[model samples]
Target: MFSHIQKIHFVGIGGIGMSGIAEVLLTLGYKVSGSDAQKTTITRRLRRRGAKVYYGHQRENLKNPHVVVYSSAIAPSNPEIVEARRLDIPLVARAEMLAELMRLKYGIAIAGTHGKTTVTSLIANILTQGGLDPTFVVGGKVKSLRTNARLGKGDFLVAEADESDRSFMHLSPTIAVVTNIDPEHMEHYRDYDELKNIFKEFCLKIPFYGVAVLCVDHPAVAAIAASFPKRFLTYGIHTKADFMAHKIKLYPFKSSFELKINGKSAGQWRINLMGSHHIQNALAAIAVGNELGIPLSSIKKGLSQFKGIGRRLEPLYKNEHQKIYVIDDYGHHPVEIRETLNAIRQTWPQARLIVIFQPHRYTRTKALFSDFTKIFDGTNELFITQIYAAGEPPIHGVSAKKLADNIHSNSFNVHYRENLNDVVHDVRGLVKKNTIVVTFGAGDVNKVGKQLSKMMKEMPLQ
Candidate 1:
């Protein structure tokens, strides 16, 4: 699709979404260059793959590029972007580039507010195991592949459709999967209805011969499916749909369930993933696999063998000596946090569930404050830090301390730590036998979990 474009430069190349596309273009033998505010592993990996990487944006960074791609996080005022526009270089949004890549293959785009990464990773795993060798791009690093993007020799291309900026509308996938829709990214939409309508439009993008896969368990998703005019299939735990999972058994680190496809029992399935949320994610992958004519045995094996993606209930360290377990998760939304805590409780019924949470964005925290207060029911103890503003200006009257105070008023064990260092120290002193310390949020909260784990490892045996 980008045959005439010889050189491509990305504005925010370190971002997970942007880096993936950069890697794919590099693999395709395109001259790739990009700039980010900071250096990260993703950027380093891209540089190693023969792409020129810059630590920060500059007008000079846009030199001799046929097209410039900028991520949603980048602003129009960025120096590189300004230079590109001034020079009349073709500037494209990251989603536009991703859509162009999809245009060259049978695209399978996974869209939703949550579970998109997991479902995309699961589908990629299933396709790889089935000998499809589909090219895939996911938001998070897949533990099995150790990377977020790969270029394969197959005709299928699997990708995660980002809805935060409503850029997912740019993608017209041959096979589309909507895991679930929730009230998120309110900054971009007027209300929940508008968000739901956008999801409907995304589903309608599928061609006449293609199909849309949706989760019927979510009431919002189910309601949208009713009005969908094109071919679609539903999967869920509570609803009787085209694909379903039943008799689910949740364990500490794994779950198993019976799978059914179109009212017929496919077989039993198991995954090394925890929680009902993850089970639903696997069910969506099952739907895609079934539609692609992959054998049930291969699907089962792929799901069962799947290790997991980074920052999704990933266990960082387990100290048998101190009986402390450290886990990190990238769940900033109230529903995601609630489900993650529920999973932790179901897995370790006897352990004290201590949560160290860093609220992601001030706007999100302000928008979902009420929901956050009630979602920590399973949390035995809560420690919150200052908000991690993902490039947005701090919204007045919205602070993590305020959230901690409100949650504390609800009679739950809540504490407010000013920073990650304080959290690490507090956790070091509070951790006792059978304590499950889970760092929660989409920001740098995982760093606290890693530090706590390192501290636990250095403690004297006792």
Candidate 2:
């Protein structure tokens, strides 16, 4: 489909996934122009790389692009889309363009509700170490890549196939990594079964020669395995699978595990990242390595060198004298929140856990408020920030304050802060000597963590 495309324009150019594709196209010598609702670091980086970027969507910005690609977030009434239709320029959803790009190479898509960013980063790291020079586009930043996307000459194209907006079904992947699927994005999907059907369709999109690597630990994931035409490769910590982690060891700052596959002992791989979820991510990467016939030692080496994906258990600072640590994560979903809190609990059981959570969207907050409340059971203290409206207008009865009130825990003292500065002050006052502050959310909540880290670093030792 992209064969006819020379000059391309992106409607949501600042999005991490969209920027990745735009960068790849630019590296391939295509003229790329795009307009975002606002400027971001990603957009600025694209500009540095010679892509024409406009600040806002306007009909005038759609001039002379052969093909126009847009994220699902772009409304149909967007000025660029309206202009594209009026000018008769070929239009495609971001997923369609992604699928077209995948068809030109050996595409490996990592799909899941949670863990897609980390898994893609792990596989990309392993591929990089194995001399594959693979190109990749993850939804989050990778510490290894120093960017969200990379342009490489190797035939491997690794991307996080997002299930949101039903975009995962568009790609025809050679190897698909299904991390785990849970009911999410209730706004788009009618029900749980509806979401499962979408995932089943995504699996069916894989060609006959393709392999689907599934997490058997999740019944939902395992149930969709049979939907694929090709035989599926399974991995997990529980139940017998093709790739499994055993003898797991998790420390305050890192984790180690022994990987086994096909009844043969693969070397033990250690990761510098935190969380048991990361160990599972490494298992998925090992499965990919085994599939591609990469040496176990190379896989282990790559995994050991892996730091982490940004905003996913990303450590920001540590002050020994103050006895405090700050971490940030993009875990807006309930399941992600649960896993992250649990991981931190295991890693730092002695430290007082203080979570600063910013609800991402009104729909998600409404749909999973109960689950969100229950997640705090594992944390000692919680601070709720105002909802990060990611273009979603606030619902009548739903807000972060309501969520804070509903969540019940013995040690959980929840407070609401509407402004970032107030939230920072509240957190600083709440944090004690032995505190591990974790900022959780998919939106600007990251800034909370960043600001806290800066404050901690600048504060005089006492």
Candidate 3:
């Protein structure tokens, strides 16, 4: 259906999802041009790959394009958007184009509020290692793939089905993996049920012969499995699932577990990734791999070889003490933060848990501030950074300091770092050896972890 398009313009092209799509289009020999608020590594990479990228949104950016694809962050008032409408060019949202592309391939959409990136990367790793060489697009960089987007000649296409703005509804995949559903995206979704129904719609889009991989750990996702007409495979830590991970052992830098499919012996598996959430993520991949008829041995090989995706409990380094562990994760949501913090606790129960959290998007912060207040229950020490405003204008009442104060009052040791530099200084001074320092966010907070790693490397041994 996209054959007629010679040129495509994207607004908000710097976004991970948008950049992944642009990479695929560039591989297909299309002239790609786009605009973003600022230059980022993703946009720089796109430009190096021969894409025409503009620094800021402009009406002229929409000129000479057969189609204009914009992200949910871009509104109707955006200059390019106005131009697209005035010029009468075909306009499509990012998700719509992504869905159209998936329809042409054997789509496998990995979706959930918490583990979408990890699960998507897991499946991509399995497919690539199995020699399927499927075209895969993930939100974060997977060390297994070496990149977020890869164009393969194989028929299979793997993507992360996003539920924000109800975007997951657009994808119809042969295999759909719903990791877990939690109350997120309160902006578009009225409540939990509204979000659940959106996922239900996404599941119904699968063909009768297709399979739905449901995470039995979450009742919301498990409940939606019944809505699908075709066979559904349930996977989780619990034995009740069709695919279950039992006797899971989570080490500081690695995890090992046994997999069982429908109460039958599958095999013992090991991955370099840490945490039980990752163990569950592996199960999701195994479910899809089995459905695609990949051998158990191949799946095992793939899972074993997978180092992990970047920014998902990705360990930077550790000193001889083995006491200091520096990790980064793209966990902007409260649910994700809770899980990551718990995972850290599991690996380092005796170590002091130090978390540097950067809240992304003003809307998300405003909508879920109360939820954020409760996320640090298990964390020993919390450092809140300045809000990472993706695009939304600051809501009048929301601020990082306010969230920090709430956490402090709610029985947690919390403090707000209004400035990143100040936060870095304080963290470096206060963080002692044997502290499990986790930097969590979807924004520039990742740089804090990197800076800490550099400083730690430069510091002399005590």
Candidate 4:
């Protein structure tokens, strides 16, 4: 804690990562203020906790702040950032601030291209259930805790290390977990080799006495494990690892599998979360729990009781009378969409699976165009909307319609809707007695599922 720096302001404070850190700072009795382009529940919650919240950015928002923290989403040319620089005040990246917070505690940082949020939440929940009330700052809201961040009295500090901006490298944690590695955040690295190298470096940052948990199923991660020269634990289903899950059984909303430690059966475990991906996440938590001397019983209870994080296959609305269920997920990448849709298909094999997918970034859509075309095969009907720019200038040749056309060429039931309202309206008409609707993406496409769920609730049973 910086005694001299009393006030800390955040730019783009509404971001999940930014908000969590802000909440932690508030709990530490610091004067926290922040600005975002829009007011959200997270921002309002911070305001109620005595942090000054601003709806829009302005030079005046930076008044008398000892330091300013900005997320990767915020541009350097923003008014508040310019004002901070003009005033000669210290400026920090969001990851820099998070690194400082972890520096003081026995840190456990989770990093990967995907499943970081779920893995971090699982570890946090396991640690919490074991009676070590740890300080946690995750990217998504853990439904069990109802908040993304908490300052605890225990010695552990758990957080998700974001690699999208290559900022996760700044963190040096006592225990580090890398779920998997893929070709993502291409904007940050020169190539796939660079991305892999950075992860190797990140794991090596662990002290001699520390440990690194890795997933061996992903080839890239497996490669990193081969190169890592330190204490490490490996977990996966397809690959032989230190921690492994086998004999998996998948249900509509849950899965059970046998857990093995070092090729010996530890126990049978079940998780409410779906997909093989989630099972791998739980395995990471188990490795961490065992390493920290927590009983397997506590880890089992923690995994079983985890309600799941928001927007990671979160059930938005369920209508028993109408026999309709709606799920919202933040899966914009091709691999994520493929796995998520596969889980939905396995869960409800009889229901008509209708998907409303909004492509996340122009760059991502452009880079993974072919993969998107092939990933939606599990859906009965697929609706595509315009790409969510996510602050990037539109790429000239990339558009949602083109993606739809490419998918259509493969004889898939895909449609392009230029308007979200029209897509929602059409979805309302398309609902049948046995239907499961899911809105998929990293952007505002979730609004379509929410509105449709509301409309379904108001409809009477036939």
Candidate 5:
């Protein structure tokens, strides 16, 4: 694919996933250029790495590149995309470019509705510790690495395969990991059964020699295991599987578990992430390590050294004397929110839970309205922000105010804040001592938690 291509341009370069891929391509000696609606920390970093980044997509930003790649978030009518089409430059989807990159290396693509970022980072860390020097492209920044993508000397290229648009079908990975499957991306599928078949098709994309590591604990994932006879491996906690965790122990901000492969005790493993969801995420990585024949000791050490992704329940600040704890997570889905809340409760059962949530896309808010209303009972205080329209036209009755009102009507204490420009002001009175302030959303709602943390850090102790 790179036979005559020297430069590549991206349409939505500042996106979390697109930035990672752009970085990898930059490191591989390609002249990279991209344009986004706004300049972000990602764009600045890419600029530092010799990428030509332009703000506000214009036809003029489409420099004469051999090929152009665009983010899924970008609309088809984007000026750069239209310009590329008129200029006769080959235009590619972001996943198509990712697939081309994977074609050049031994790919390990992690796919699922959730946990793909953490799982990809864990596998990369383990492989690195095992002396593979593997390349990785994660959707979120890894705390330890301080970056989301790297081009390594080894042959393996581990990446997070996105399923939001069913773009994950573009790659043929040597080891495919499906953490779990749920009814998500309903915009892409007609029904749940169709989504299941799409995932199964993704698993079947692997060659005869490749393996699909699935989480059978999810009935949808297990339902598709029959698609690949001997080509599938299983990993789970509640059910007996090929790779499983047992005797799990979770502490504040950390967790450990006994590892069992093929029903035989491999060893006890520990990771620097909390919650059963994290434990399940670790199991997926462990299964990958075991499949690669990486020594168990290396796997254990890698997991222990893992500091986790930036927003997968990342703690922004902690002050025991002031009893102020704040965390931010990229959990917009109901299952993710439930698991994160469960993890928080398991770690700090006594702390008063305060959640600030912002709905992401209008489509998702409307599709999962019932589930969203049901998950807020456990929180002592809840602050709901207006929906962030991520380039989507608003659905008629799918405002965040409606969701908040519905939850309030359910006899829960919910406060709706329409403006988040001053998120701290919107909920300052609610931040009492001995409370764990957590932000749940994929949008800028995390700013609330960040602001709260800053306020707590600067405030004098009583």
Candidate 6:
């Protein structure tokens, strides 16, 4: 705790990562203030926590702060950032602030192209169950905890390392985890090699006394373990690893697995989540908790109690009366979409699946277009919405319509709608009994899920 740093401002505070950090600072008795263009639940919660919240950015919003924190998504020209610089206030990248927090505690940072949020939340939940009272800043709302962050008294500090801009390198955690590496966030890196090398460097940042947990299931991630620079543990079902999970059983909203430590029986674990991927996330949590000397019983209990993170295959509405289910997820990347859909298929194999996918960033869409096109094979229907800019100027030839057109999945009906509301309207007619509709993206696409669920639920129960 920096006694001298009382007042801190965040430029893009509504972001999941930035909001969690701001909440932690607030709980630490700091005067927190921030601004974002959208008035969201996150901003409102910050205001309720006594942080000064501004709906829009302006120079006036930067009123005399000791330091300023900005997320990777914030533009350099943001008025609050510009004003803070002009006023000679310290400007800290969100990751830099996270690193500072990690420095003060027994850091357990989860980094990777995918499942960072889930893995971070998993470790935090497990440690909490172990009575460690860890401070954690998750990138999404933890459904069981009801908040993305907390300032606990324990030494362990759990958090997600944002690798979008190679910013995760700022963190040197006591324990590090990389869930998996994919070709993502290419807009910020020079090339794929740089991305992989950066992850390698992140694992190397582990202190000699620290542990780095990685999933060797991903070939790229497995390649990083060769001659790795630190004490590291590998977890997966496919490849031979230090930690492995087998006897996997995935239900609609739950999964069970048996763990083995270097071919020795550990214990059976259950997660209140779907997919073998989630089981893999739980493996990382198990590895870290065991390294920290937490009891295997405690680790098993935590994994069993993992309710899940917000917007991560979160069920919005399940009308038992009509049998229509709506799920909302922050699945923007191709790998995420593929895994989630596959999980849904295995969970509700007989249910018709309809997906409303809003492409997140133009750069991501352009970079992963071919991958995106091939992921909708089993979908009953696919609705592509206009790209959510996230402040990125539109890149030529990277529209959602183009993706829709290129998605020549004969097995599924694909359509593109430029308007979100129109997509919602169309979805109303698509959902019926035994249908599972998912809103997929890292943007405001959840709005469609919410609206569709509401409209569909209010209809007559025939």
Q: Candidate 3: what lDDT?
A: 0.86
lDDT of 4 by residue, 254-349 (tens): 899999999999878999998888999999999999999999999999998899999999888876666678899999998888888888888788
Give the number of the best model, judged by lDDT: 4
Give the TM-score comparing model 5 with the true structure, all chains together: 0.97
Report the C-alpha lDDT of model 5 over 1-462, residue by residue, as the tens digit. Answer: 646898899999999889988999999899999998887889999999999999998999977899999877888898888899999999898999899999989899999999999999999999999999988999998877788999999989999988899898899998899988888889999998898888888888887888889998888888877556658889899988998899988887899888888999987788899999999999999888888999889889899889988888898988777676889999999999999999898888888888889999999998999999988767887888899889999999889899988885443478888877555775566677788888888888888877777777787345
Error of 2 at 93 (Å): 0.8
Indicate the worst ten consecutive residues by lDDT in candidate 2. 222-231
- Pairwise TM-score winner, candidates 3 and 5: 5
**For model 5, where is the 10-residue window of minimal lDDT?**
404-413
Question: Which residue runs of candidate 1 sit more than 4 Å off their true CA positions?
Answer: 320-323, 409-411
Quote the RMSD, in angstroms, for model 4.
Answer: 1.3
Give the 10-residue window scoring lowest on summed lDDT in candidate 3: 406-415
Candidate 5 regions with alpha-carbon error over 4 angstroms: 409-412
Cα lDDT tens digits, model 1, 1-462, are 647888999999999989999999999999999999898988889999999999988998876899999988898899998999899999999999999999989999999989999999999999999999999999999988778999999989999999999999999999999988889989999999999999989989999999999999998889878888999999999988988888998986799888888889877888999998999999999889989999988988888778999999998988666567899999999889888998888888888778999999888999999999788886778898999998889988999999988885444589998878998988788888888989888888899988888887788336
Ranking by TM-score: 4, 1, 5, 6, 2, 3
Flag clash pairs in model 1. Answer: none
TM per candidate comes to: 0.97, 0.96, 0.96, 0.98, 0.97, 0.97
Provide the overall lDDT of each model, using Cα atoms, as 2-decimal numbers. Answer: 0.90, 0.86, 0.86, 0.91, 0.88, 0.88
Q: Which residue ranges in model 2 land beyond 4 Å of their true spot?
A: 1-4, 226-229
Q: Residue 10 of candidate 5: its Cα lDDT?
A: 90
Model 6 lDDT-worst window of ten: 453-462
Candidate 2, 51: how far from true, in Å?
Answer: 0.5
